[model samples]
Target: MVTNIAKAILSVLLAAVVSGCALGISEIPVAELEKRYASNPPLYIDVDGLQVHYREEGKDNDHTLVMLHGILASLHNWEVWSRELAGRYRVISLDLPGHGLTGPANFEYNTENYIQFINSFASRLGLEKFTLVGNSLGGYFAWNYAIRYPQQVEKLVLIDTAGFPLKKIPFPVRAFTAPLLGEISMHFTPRIASSILLREVYAEPSRISEAMTERYYELQLRPGNRRASQTLFKRNLEILRQEPSGLEQLTMPTLLMWGEQDHWIPADPHLKRWQQALPHAKVVIYPDAGHMPMEEIPVRSARNLHQFLSGAEITDTSE
Candidate 1:
């Protein structure tokens, strides 16, 4: 009986290994990714020796809006917002060093390095001052940039930003940060994993279209992106551990937006903490939205942003 049980366990383990191998993903060529995702010719700029993927849209105006996406997300996440705001304001979105088509970076993906990189990118674009907008980890960068370089930022918008220390690391992030598991994950990341993450970010899973999932999964398979993302996760863990400070210094016109259904960075305590820090900030909570209000409910969220920037009364438009 004992010998039979041992054999059964071995059989199950073998089956699991075979299943995992069958689902393994491989890196997609950069050219192919560009063809699928980019315009006639992909827009790229040399920042810190890396060919950074970016998009600049809207009318040529003095008022500029620079948007940043969260970790594991690309500039494409801001497509709706960029389109809605582009008519009035010069909107620019970029794939950060690791995420999106930007792939890996020459320098470290630490806190200070990213801040400097943003500054360099802005300098290259000859942007004197612009409204800085970011979501999730991008929001973390936005607030920090506003705090560090107060004069250059006219306004700040943070959507489910990460500043406060997390009680526990999310499973996906934790898995990618682990030594052995992280290396394994780089090559074996399946499409289902990407879909699950996308659903988690949306309060309603129905909002995640098939094309969106495909884009995310394919981007994760972009050459050099997985390794860079792994490195970023490790660096982010260290940064998240440090207690958040300097928030009180963000006296600029600040707009804090959070999704009430956000599981990643729940609105309860984190929103309250941000409120206390930036008492003057205009706060908006989307009732039916999750971590990404911009992506989940783009139209209403974009309207609120316009109202905030235009100094109009923020109406209760919950969708």
Candidate 2:
């Protein structure tokens, strides 16, 4: 009887250990992220009765680079590039409604809503014309914005964007996109969930550092971000589904960059579509990189961007 009791205790302990490990896998402590990057206090702009938060770096009235980040991400994603590009071009990175320091939009979170957000952001900043650079969902917004306000856009750069709907989405996104299931899942997500998200953002998982994961986690926990993200996730399909055929309509010099190993939105079909639609647009596929090419291949990505912005001749067009 004593031996049986000991075995039972050991079984209970083993179960607890397994559960703890699962919970700990992605948890990133919020305090650590805040310790690393001091929150650049937000400048609020009243847009459609909601306060929108944004950070403006570099000189105003210069040629501008307006950066839009991906889904579930914040303007902080562009920290590396903003510093590099600020000297040459005024850089404006803002938290999109329903993400980062910015809370949910008073209106819907669709393409039209985002375009309005972009317009409001630019007009408030007094920008006449600017280069637009976006990643993932931002990539979608960049293209959409360029199409709607062609004259306002001087140049376009799409980094691992997600405008065209793929037949299959990444498992995590699919989980989050599901109706009631997504809502239920959000409640149970632990701190380590951020690391899992970071892992998905990169083609090379090893590139995701502890510090980066922590930053992403803290940003997610900021005031209204979690609930807003959940709502955005549920509505993403509707928003992304309405992708306009603006590739042919855009005349601005365009650069399309992608990670060849991207599992989130695979390269072949999307690349092929873009190439066929925008025959004049330049395309570059980074072999070792995954979904987030800017993060995965920042140096090369930055170089390509600089060259493209400088009007250097691009050689790669073959599909």
Candidate 3:
């Protein structure tokens, strides 16, 4: 009877092992992913002890447009805007500390670290001052950087910025911002999830294409990218409080753009606070767009940006 009991115990242990294995993450070949995704040859620089990758385009003699992209997004996301704006101005976009071709460094992925890197990056590039433009997380950095280094930012553009305390945070954002919960997803490759998340950001789902999915998937798997992502998301919840505290200090000429259908950040409540804080701000709301107006409706947004940058009073085109 004792022998039979021992055999039963072994069977139960094996069952438990199988059950755990059932939830194991699938293995992907990083080599194959990189071959297709790492297409762009990047210009390199050493900023804040990190080897940074960036793309510099447009005329050297023209005024500069220094662009920053959102969380988990790379310099590639600004490809369309950079191309369109480069014709008129010097356009430079960089992969943030832990995003894109740029590898991770030993620093907290918080606003302070990002702002320091931005300052160092501009100084290295000999950019005394330039128009600062950012989307989502990048926008949060842009506005704050304006406050911190008002001397270095000539103008400010915020696209669905994330500096305020969100009244109703989205499911994916809430999940990834939770400490242990988000880190758990770090082990899994994000190719499929990237597509899903991209879909979530757009009012029209078809905008999440195969090419976009491939790029986001492979770039995210870059060494240390996944871990940095978890750290940034968890730390972002902490920064939201710190972000709004100094909005009044950002007195630069500002342009605020929002997607009316933005699920990530609603336009109505936040815009009111932004206007209250920066009384010298201009606001535009896009009717048929979502979180990513720069991508969702690039040309129309371009018209607006071009007007604003040219010091022309911007007319609302949402009607």
Candidate 4:
């Protein structure tokens, strides 16, 4: 009877494995996902072998603003802020390489690749010189862009930027950057991971809704998006190891905004570093906000941004 019981347990385990394999989560159709997530169908253009996706709104005068989204975040994150700024300056936003409808492109896919992509995209769009704004990973690229091509960026805005090393990496980034586990995760990621990420980014858990989390999950499953995400996470880890140089060297009129309650990377240490590096930078902190202050307090952030832009003269950085 004991031997029969052991045999039954083994049989059940084998059946479970088979069942899991059969019922594995599969890629959702891009058409279906775009229906809900792609609120506005972005205009596409080919840039350096990738069919780039971007939106250009607001006035077409010389005043221009180029915005970049964070890791795993698309141009949609700037929806609220875009509405506020688009009326005056020409606001252009994009999906950088590995994220959004832009899809994944074959490249080294490092921070450098992003820098080059930005250059190419701007060149193709005939962007002479524009204020550059970025958040999180987007902010990481923004500073690097400013440092490398100072001639192209008129002003810099960093929202919870990620150029410096971190005390602890976020779990989604950690999990996706792991070796074999990262590979397996592309196929079997749990839906709950999206909820956890959303909650961590926002100060108030109430801000995250089921529909928001659902959209994030659906976007991650956008064909090659998961694999691109893994590559981006791994590459960023490698970049963050080295302390970035030339923070003080970025002399462009700078704006640094931080959410005081940000859990990912605390405000004090990073903000202090920014203050030391860019002494003349205009700083703003939001008390109740988390990592995503732009989303949490769009109107306030927009008002601050407008005030800064209005006061400062738009320099011809293209020279």
Winning candidate number (TM-score): 1
Q: Cα deviation in Å at residue 96, candidate 1?
A: 0.4
Where model 3 places Cα greater than 4 Å from the true spot, the runs are: 1-18, 22-40, 177-180, 241-243, 316-319
Model 2 lDDT tens row, 272-317 = 7777777888888888888887776676677678778888865433
Give me the displacement of residue 63 in model 1, in angstroms.
Answer: 0.8
- What are the lDDT scores of the predictions, listed in order? 0.85, 0.73, 0.77, 0.80
What tens-digit string does per-residue lDDT give for candidate 3 at 30-82?
45544554435537889867888788888564688899998778888777787
Model 4, span 84-110: residue lDDT tens: 988888988888888887888778888
Distance from true location, Cα of 265 in model 1, Å: 0.5
Angstrom error of the Cα, residue 101, model 1: value is 0.9
Pick out the ten consecutive residues of candidate 4 with the lowest summed lDDT: 310-319
Task: Show where candidate 1 strays beyond 4 Å.
Answer: 1-24
Ranking by lDDT: 1, 4, 3, 2
Candidate 3 is scored at a TM of 0.86
